[model samples]
Target: MKTDDAERPNMAVSIGRLMLKNPVITASGTFGYGEEFAPYLDLGRLGGMVLKGISEKPRPGNPPPRIAETPSGLLNAIGLENVGVDAFVTEKAPFLETLDTTVIANIFGESADEYARVAGKLTDVKCVDALEVNISCPNVNRGGMDFGADPEQAAEVTRAVKEATDLPVIVKLTPNVTDITAVARRVEAAGADALSLINTIRGMSVDVYTARPRLANVTGGLSGPAIRPVAVLMVWETVQAVSIPVIGMGGIMNARDALEFLIAGARAVEVGTANFVNPAAVLDIIDGIERHLGDAGVDDINDIIGTLDCRRK
Candidate 1:
């Protein structure tokens, strides 16, 4: 017998010290400084919102034609364009302070010291609940993906940020590496409170007629449904390899996709590119997950985390 969908389950979940009312979060870069989506949906309804990647200083980002559509995903070389930490705190923090939901700041930097500096800057911000270190931005020429791809560099960055901020630190991982679990373990040891993966896969598109790259950068991070499978696998593996919580995101569009990540091992899931297509996608996912839980007679969502049955045939 199936339970009625009208009954709501306990959807609250924790990632390290960050407690989300539900498991659905808006991925960084997809949701701008929490102001852009205000006209579309209630920011307080989301479990958490990871703001666009912020740097130590303002970034102009790459030139035009920074985004392109692929078969089932998007290629972007936006270069982590942002108003920087100073502007974000002065201009954006007030709005976020009014919201009831958790707000995680996604930050990037050119070096370990810079990462520490950025993290330190947000330490006194009352609205920022946690920090999601964006070490996996592939489109950037310096820092970003470079530190994430190497375990030593990744750990160093994690340690630096942890030392700088009292907020829970989540190191977002890059899938372009050969062994994601290796970096996961290192970050965990380096004192990362939680982890998020897999940041867009490195890819490129070309214009056959023009004999030129589709994006001006020649390469960019591929995101959306195309990378969901890879994100699931990495989340599954990283959860197994590390003790910290795992926040999963790649191509999550609905509750089913989010459930897949939870079952695979993610404690919470982030809606990325899907938000671009549907502003209400995050709320829909939250509703869908609640329905799924009620139908399954599950009173709590935590029971499903890393509950995948890997029995061999």
Candidate 2:
């Protein structure tokens, strides 16, 4: 099942200095270290594989009942559980180096210093092509507000990460704020090489008869089909506000859904909740995008990026 090179569309995409084979990357926290999905699909087929978020120290994560389901959406309260940076460097780095795809490390912490340390730790790892800063975590020094919720905090963290590593830095944005573009601009100004946005929206589910929350954590990030529209909207608004390559995510479940983000202005789209439903989701999206391009007479994937016609008819 292969299309000849001359007949096939070019799917290559660039995010800063890192070049991906395609633009269908697996979202961080959704795809686990890339090694886990190797048996399910060809990991090399993906443009990039973003590992689960790693922290300054290992976290037990929220206790069980960490997941809940709803109509067309899923909720998770995993609490950013990870093997910690040092352990990840030893346990995960070797396996990651073997993969043919671009490997991106998603990192987060309670404070800017922690983020800096984590980025510093991975700078020497040859397997990690870039550092993706997950700014959705709380700023421990500043009460409990999210680093991404405030322009200054977000940029500060971004600056910290950029200063710590020579690797390209891609700051992942959260949708919990009033104006996402404001944060996007700040991060870019702070020296982020690229950006990925519309992380899961804060949401919850409740049990009827039990008169209690469905998850042990009570509240979790909502993802899946339900958030695609909101994610696309933010991606569109953000692309208009910033010059860096913006990768879009949140609730992307299929090739058609993936295309929505691409058409709306995202340079790439990350498959999140869909991975849980289908381990081969990334492969499917790549194939679907190729087919779509062939059918539309498009020769290169980048030709269609940010081509949305928003003018009112």
Candidate 3:
């Protein structure tokens, strides 16, 4: 039997300085600016919403056929299409201010200085709760994946952004690396308040008949159910490597998947590709987590985080 709404377990969790009512957050890019999904569900019910990646200036993104479907995942080369930071503060921030959920601004830049500049602009925005530095965008020509791949460069970027803003800075890490823990430790040393991992792995698809790439960019970030296991492992490893909170994401499609990340040691989980398949997936995940807690007689969601038994026989 399921517990009633009043009897459900407490789902609140914290990410660095930002406190969430629950642990389910909508990953950046997938949820747009939050206005698009307003009609489908109640935005206030969510733990948090990470808007699309924003740059100091507007980007048109890649050409047509920016997205392609895979067996159990998606390849996207949409770039970081956004209206720029100035417009976001003036136009988008107002609408986000009206919402009850925490609004985290995801910012990216081509250079370390540029990252600071963009973070500086967001500091005055009362609506923005925190800043999620997107240094893992594989589709961009420069600055995205490169900063995330090297420990020195990753620390430089994180330091620049932290120096520019008072908001909690969460560094989003890329999995397309030899050791993700190396990068996570670097960012943590640079004063990052939190970390969100396994940002899409680099992948590609080709049309067998045409002998051409499926995505316009030739390669794109791979997301969806295909990356869950990898994400779980990365999250587990990263949690052991750093003291800051880790927000795990990358192929989370249901409550079970979200629970896996939390159990592996993620303080919170983000729903990325799952949003495209079902707009209400985040809500379902939250409900499922509540039920899991109640059935197990768990009083708090934090009790299960990083509770994996590692005792060797």
lDDT of 3 by residue, 41-80 (tens): 9999999999999999999999979999987999999989
| Local distance difference test values of all predictions, in order | 0.92, 0.88, 0.94
lDDT of 2 by residue, 1-313 (tens): 7868888899999987889999998988888998888889988788998889888899777788988888899888788888999999999999999889898999988889999999999999889999889887431233123788899999999999999999999999989899999999999999999999878788888898999999988888888899888998999999999999999987877789889999998988888899999999888889999999999999999998989997999
Cα lDDT of model 1 by residue, 1-313, tens digit: 3355455578899997689999999999998987899999998899999999889999999997999999999999999889999999999999999999899999999999999999999988999999999889999889999999999999999999999989999999999999999999999999999999999999999999999999999999999999889899999888889888999988998899999999998999999999999988998899899888877888899987788999997
Ranking under lDDT, best-scoring first?
A: 3, 1, 2
Ranking by TM-score: 3, 1, 2
Cα deviation in Å at residue 292, candidate 1? 0.3
The runs of at least 3 residues in candidate 1 whose Cα sits more than 4 Å from the true structure, single-residue gaps closed, are 1-7
| Overall local distance difference test of candidate 2 | 0.88
For model 1 the TM-score comes to 0.97
Candidate 1 Cα lDDT to native: 0.92
**In model 1, how large is the Cα lDDT of residue 115?**
98
- Model 2 residue 40 CA deviation (Å) reads 0.7
Considering only N, C-alpha and C atoms within 3 Å, which residue pairs clash in candidate 2?
224-251
Q: Which stretches of candidate 2 lie over 4 Å from their true place?
A: 137-145
